[model samples]
Target: MPAKKAANQPRKSMKIKKGDTVKVIAGTDKGAQGKVISVLREQQRVIVEGVNRVKKHTKVVDAGGRSGKSGGIITTEAPIHVSNVMLVEGDGVTRVGFRRDEVTKRRSDGSTYTAHRSVRVSRSTGEEI
Candidate 1:
């Protein structure tokens, strides 16, 4: 018999965003790199292009008494856990880092202030992403 597993696990917040190129760090697709197509925030999973491809047998339900229909195996991407992927920076994979911009901006009250907007940077080259 299989042992019972933990009923609850904390969901982790993912730093990767849509359109970011990432490399699969774990799982069967390890080392496969692709651009992120979508990020499932609640599930902590990311769908990467050309990664985790799975075949789905889909059928088109028609109104003609199901007489004429087309069904075929279609290949599509499957979502992979966020932890199994790493952000790609430059020609290599790098961890993400946050930094504040040094630019200043004027406030609505006619006062100037330092606008420290957060920016994603590469941990290896320290360059903005």
Candidate 2:
């Protein structure tokens, strides 16, 4: 029963990582692509550069604690749903798939080993990414 329960656990997290290139698949940013700048695991959101821009009101800093300093509006990138983005391939234009590599068998005296490898494949050209 324990073994079956362990297998039913939800996935660890999303496969996407920081600095990874991703393409927007949904929303107003559809077809837009950019490098992943940040990931919000708690909210399941990602902020891609130049993807979602929003205005922020922030207090302006004074150089010498002067009262003349004034606050102004600032524009910045906002977090977007992670589901809208897809991992981009090496070519920088297509999405890719991840696959585990097959392990090789080895025997010496009394030993067994297994190796795991993952690679991305371009969905457009059917080539390794």
Candidate 3:
């Protein structure tokens, strides 16, 4: 038997999504802003462009007998906790809020319908994020 999907499911990770611009609120990268490149749900971390860089030492290896090279320092992106970041709005930093927009009915022939859509917006600016 397989697990069943429920009518309503709670997300385990942060609400931030890729392509969203975020500012680091705490840590060494505080005040730094960048676009979200990826999200690590299990670790509760996020990778932002040009943020949380760490040097990694690696040795070059040969697969088929080419050669084994010397080790060197390589800079790479490190994971940062999602709680240290905040979504930036037009005016300032703010949390994400959901709002539902009531759809207006439009009749082409003789049909009537209503649709409701939810959208995320910035609490500070009250604008769509």
TM-score of 3: 0.72
Give candidate 2 misplaced runs (Cα > 4 Å). Answer: 1-11, 61-70, 90-98, 102-129
In angstroms, the error of model 3 at 19 is 0.9
lDDT of 2 by residue, 12-124 (tens): 46557789889988998898988899998867899998898899998887746657676799888899988888887764566556778878667886676888788766677
lDDT of each: 0.89, 0.80, 0.85
Work out how many backbone clashes candidate 3 has: 0
Candidate RMSDs in order: 4.5, 7.0, 5.9
Which candidate, 2 or 3, has the higher lDDT? Answer: 3
The TM-score ranking, best first, is 1, 3, 2
Q: Best candidate per lDDT, number? A: 1
lDDT of 3 by residue, 6-109 (tens): 75767574678899899999999899999999999867899999889999988766545555465679998898999999987764689988889888677998
Ranking by lDDT: 1, 3, 2
Error of 1 at 73 (Å): 1.7
Give me the runs in candidate 1 sitting further than 4 Å from their true place. 1-13, 63-70, 107-111
Better of 1 and 3 by lDDT: 1
